[model samples]
Target chain A: MTEERRPFVSARTVAERAGVSRSAVSRTFTDGASVSEETRRKVLEAAGELGYHVNHLARGLRERSNIVCLVVADMTTPIRARLIDVLTRKLQAAGKVTMVINTGTDEQSVASAMRQTLNYRADATVFLSGTPSAKLIETSLANGQQVVLINRDDPLTGCHNLGVDNEMAGREAFFLLRRAGCTRLALVTSTAHTASLIERERVFVAVAEAAGLPVAVMAAGPTTYASGYESARRLFGRSDGPDGVFCVTDLLALGFMDAARHEFGLTLPDQLCLVGFDDIEEGAWESYKLTTFAQPFAEMGDHVVDLLAAPVPVIPGRRIFQPVPIWRKSIRASAL
Target chain B: MTEERRPFVSARTVAERAGVSRSAVSRTFTDGASVSEETRRKVLEAAGELGYHVNHLARGLRERSNIVCLVVADMTTPIRARLIDVLTRKLQAAGKVTMVINTGTDEQSVASAMRQTLNYRADATVFLSGTPSAKLIETSLANGQQVVLINRDDPLTGCHNLGVDNEMAGREAFFLLRRAGCTRLALVTSTAHTASLIERERVFVAVAEAAGLPVAVMAAGPTTYASGYESARRLFGRSDGPDGVFCVTDLLALGFMDAARHEFGLTLPDQLCLVGFDDIEEGAWESYKLTTFAQPFAEMGDHVVDLLAAPVPVIPGRRIFQPVPIWRKSIRASAL
Candidate 1:
């Protein structure tokens, strides 16, 4: 457009117009600095005449920007996607701007993302993944940055941790499968390095071992649909495969179900029963009808934002939630 | 935890330490400004000694932050979730930070979101929804901001638009259904206010009316699974329902498929043929196996970010994509 860059109104001009000292104009703009009511009125009038607006970047040089940084490993996941959607809405409503960083599941990427956020001098930071560097967190905490960790548990004094109760969820899955009269139970999951998955698998296997149930553990490369399908093939290929399988995630369960029914020619609820975590929209589809646990994503989002928006809690409490189980056609009716 | 805020290194300190004029220090930081190598070296040494980082907020007051604002109506939608994920990765790789805002599908909320972006002085703004305000667009354009619109068609001179060929998609749906030897046809969709949906429905209805086909237009409340199921019940409850049904989206198609099979006791691709848009992950489930059109989200995201990261295109252009139809079990084999 070839528009010329207009010169900004200086405090000197406001001072001259207001018939006050330049320090008066400066004090008027500075928050909590003393300025008489008469001088403030004169500065305000002169500033209005010149159409002068405070340079927030210049102001931010002296203070913190009302910018919150949310670092997530991935946003494409259904749970994360829904959580981010709610978070952005709530934060925006609370008059806070949020910058989202999608750091891949690698230590180097996570470290780089943390460095970038630190450079931004964000007022607060929220780690949506579990892999944030301890050194980075310590640095941010040292700088008096309020850090909130979601889906991660850490005993650090400076950060607040929020997560789902994976252990309880694991126990529920074991009992649900046993009640369905499935003597053989299995757990299907990926080797993805998420703390939530690790906890769920740990507890589920421990419970099964305690009860002396015949259980199989199938692990795959990644937590994707293809991985789920591959895990299903490896688990079900054996003659002594489990009849009831609990998938660590809904997406994996979907993949397992599709592979079992289409490629393996297995009918669900008769030959096998499957359960999944995360009652995502697809779980309720007529085709899958997956019995699953619904992550309290909406509540978690609300709580996280509330903690972030408010002053640091007195004790930096750890908030944990138990996922709710949703029943569908994937499980036998007798179990319900 | 009670660490005091460290004092920031000011340009005056650098000037004094380097034994140079304050203007010389400012010119060194200013891009493309004249500064001798000796003076630059001195300023760098002095800055290092002082552990000084350029106050980006202060610098932003003069120029713009490398911040790109992404405005989406809802990130919970599958397509948007995938798009945002790719955009975040690509933008981060390009050294640009992204702030996401979820403005609900309403004029007031969209306008408010736009205002917030402008206040942040976003170097570039990308609207992932079609409902952005025209006035806001003009103001941002006048301010020389590179604005990109995805899934929205506009004749504005300065903004680049990326979207799918909704009209062509609609026609393809009609022909595919007709080829299945289904005389009865119907289009199922929500009353949501997306330009893409509007265009798709317009063409579908026009072609059906032109061909003198008996078509039922079933409209639901929101573009949700429950809405899709409700629409299916309303459509199928009638005695003379269409044998071939086209859902505007994959989620809706899933809902209809479930309701048709379970509630109505109808089999897919036998009693009724179904075609959906957007090849979402759930569509491939063993239960549905929905035949649908897949939007090239990854390609579109790359193009959008490329446009945003690079200098504004010499001539702002419109990029339209043709969705590829994915064949599955939902539609009659004869249709292929």
Candidate 2:
């Protein structure tokens, strides 16, 4: 490679240029290391002239890399994108760099992502999605890397589990819809069957069943806007359709609302009432104004960073955050 | 760290356990290194059992890190998010990890992000946003690192510049609105005068001036939804507002449309015509069928990866991709 042909500027070069010892140059670069102000100025000036950057890779071998790996699937999704943005900014504030591993909804890819975390010797790994193998978790723990799982009930030992209360949100959605004076009930979900989605679906269905209300559950396709649109078509195509619907995601809810309005000529709250999970920014748009459960992105990010910043290996435990209820025009005022 | 208390499993341990030489263990772990199949299998088994991961940081000191740094600002913005998603997925497929440096629209952050690139010895650094200093570019080139600037007109030597044809898109927007028989014209932009935004605004204003048409420009705040909404309120709040509006971004256009429709009670295409840049996914939503110019995200990502994969340093030049026009309900039929 052409890079190899050029000699890499080392601390020795900086030291000679600054007329200082190699150790002084090293101390000047090392974080929190003590160095005289005069020596630091000299070293920095010389280093700047020589284009000498501290080899963080080599330093990482001795100490922590301060790199955190985020293993995520479907990163382009609105909710996921928002979550990543929050986590990355929070981690950066904590003096850690984020390495995003896009494992596209596959177990094998998730395993590979975990392997990369170990390869880089990342200080921590946060799983925003995908189910990693138990063996990989064990390997990560053995290598001194903290593993944090979000919105997953994997019951894996030696990892922090942080998730929203999906069951509570689901139950609340049913109650909110019922309070809107809707008789027929339905649930719009996707075939993804992720832990959080499944939990929300199961609880909502159980709540409606206990109240002697018939509920139609549809998993038309993957958790996407198209799937929600398809679900609306199938459900509302019938003469007797749901008057109250609870969607597992904001994307799905928005799609269902559009198809219901434009295709079926149904007005929200009058002909149909809808509740969605994950209060994404689009949900608050003047057009959609979707009433949904808001995931505590900032709070969750703070918790993760706090765990990583701990001086000692943190006690691995479950930290369930409550999803805040965001009321908009999608649901009737009576529900509030 | 508790990790230091536990002895790190070394290659010697793996070699002894596998009944192979140290060189065999090393070769088995190193990519493209020659090792017998049986020896490789034995080494892997021993390494897996012992939970020994190859220190990629140390390996990167000798070889390339295979890390690509992406310096961006406002990553949560729809267009930036879409671009990042495409780039990360593509880079991962090419066996490189993505390090996103969120440089928050500040010059200092851009410099720090470049330093991080040098510290990690990334194979390449792509500036998705922010204008890095010429001195940093020279240092990066001197260190044999490929620098690729996107959507920036900075003629820094030794760096590849790839961007969309903002001038063409801006001019096309004007003519499209003119074809719709809208005499009065205005441009909805933001206070964040990035290179692309400035170019689009400049060209659009120049084109209108050349046509002897008065153009109203409003930059109430940053390039954001709220800013767009505020701009629309300010523009429409006036009685003699322009009927034809060109928004520099889809986000701005969506917000402008929402405010015009809900607040000002303006009907689209009949009372007003709108054009936007960046055909983000949200722009295609049923509520906001926004006419926009589509940025070639996939093509740009392919070009970046190809540049990084070149065997030798590529000749630094500009590659401008044409933005494709997306017809939607926001523009009049005559415009099509």
State the lDDT of candidate 1 residue by residue for B35-109, as single tens digits: 999999999899767645455566667665778889997688887888888898888888788989888768888
lDDT of 1 by residue, A1-336 (tens): 444433445678889999999899989988899999999999999986764545445556666676888899768778778778878888878768899999876788887777666666777788877467777676666555678888776566667788888999899989888888888888988887577888888899899889998678888877777788888898878887778998999989989998888888989888889989988777777778899999887788777678767754334678898899898988888887
Displacement of residue A279 (Cα, Å) in model 2 is 1.1
lDDT digits (tens) for residues A81-173 of candidate 2: 888888988888888888999887687888889888888889999999897888888888877788999999868888999999998999999
Q: What are the clashing pairs of model 1?
A: A287-B287
Query: Which stretches of candidate 2 lie above 4 Å from their native place?
Result: A1-7, A31-41, B1-8, B31-38
The residue-level lDDT of candidate 2 at A298 comes to 95
Determine the C-alpha RMSD for candidate 2 after optimal superposition of all C-alphas.
2.1
Model 2 TM-score, all chains together: 0.96
Which candidate number maximizes DockQ?
Answer: 2
Instruction: Estimate, for each residue in B64-120, the C-alpha lDDT of model 2 and write its tens digit.
Output: 788999888877788888888888988888888999887766878888889888888
